[model samples]
Target: MNRFATLFSASALSTIAFGADSYAAMPHPGTEPEQQLETTITRLSPSAYNVVLIESLRDDHSEPPFANVTPQSHEARLVQASVIANPALSRKLQAQNVELDNIVGAETAADGSVTFYLR
Candidate 1:
């Protein structure tokens, strides 16, 4: 019985040592630096626009060419303009000029990409 107990104790110690070694080798989540999101806008057409979000490691500068330029998000906005006038035989229809509002939608991805939609 004493020999069996010794064997059991040795097995448990080996398991614990193996577990501790693996845990030490594993990378910690806090070791990685935080990423920042950058947004860019592109005009697709006269009434359509595309916004792209990119994740960057640096806060002041963004390296798209060499760095890991992961696209985090994408957003599209459509602009509509119309004229409101009463129906009249003599009245000429005039198109109303419209401007885009300063409203935007944004989303973030797990990889650190951020997408923004502007209208």
Candidate 2:
């Protein structure tokens, strides 16, 4: 009886571990955008980021080249709440006739929120 119980427990443990690994292997639908953005942002210096704002888009998704960037590798979160929260940045960009496409800065948290940066 003890041998049977041990076998059952071991099987249960193996099943749980396998299940956790499978879940981890699957791509997270929510984290995708932030992960991509983080890859792009890390490729730039502060000056480069500013210049990027003035850059044009070939299509709605023709963002800067960040082909091999890794998210969560940066020193900080890539979006700044203050920038998104500020009326001034919006106004400045608007004055330049650049409609705020997104705000992929380096200081925002990822909580599965639809941030302006991820737009």
lDDT of each: 0.33, 0.45
Question: What would you estimate as the lDDT of candidate 2?
Answer: 0.45
Residues 1-119, candidate 1, lDDT per residue (tens digit)? 99999999999999999999999977676442121111211211122222332333245565432133222222112111111111220022112121222213334445443333332
The 10 consecutive residues of candidate 1 with the worst lDDT sum are 81-90
Please provide, for model 2 over 25-115, each residue's C-alpha lDDT reduced to its tens digit, 9 standing for 90 to 100: 8877755555555544433232232424313432477554332233233422344333334455545545755444444433223442222
Candidate 2 Cα errors over 4 Å, as ranges:
21-27, 30-33, 44-77, 80-119
lDDT of candidate 1 vs native?
0.33
* lDDT of model 2, residue 101: 40
Number of the predicted model whose lDDT against the real structure is largest: 2
Clashing pairs in 2: 77-106, 77-107, 78-105, 78-106, 78-107, 79-105, 79-107, 79-108
TM-score of each: 0.29, 0.30
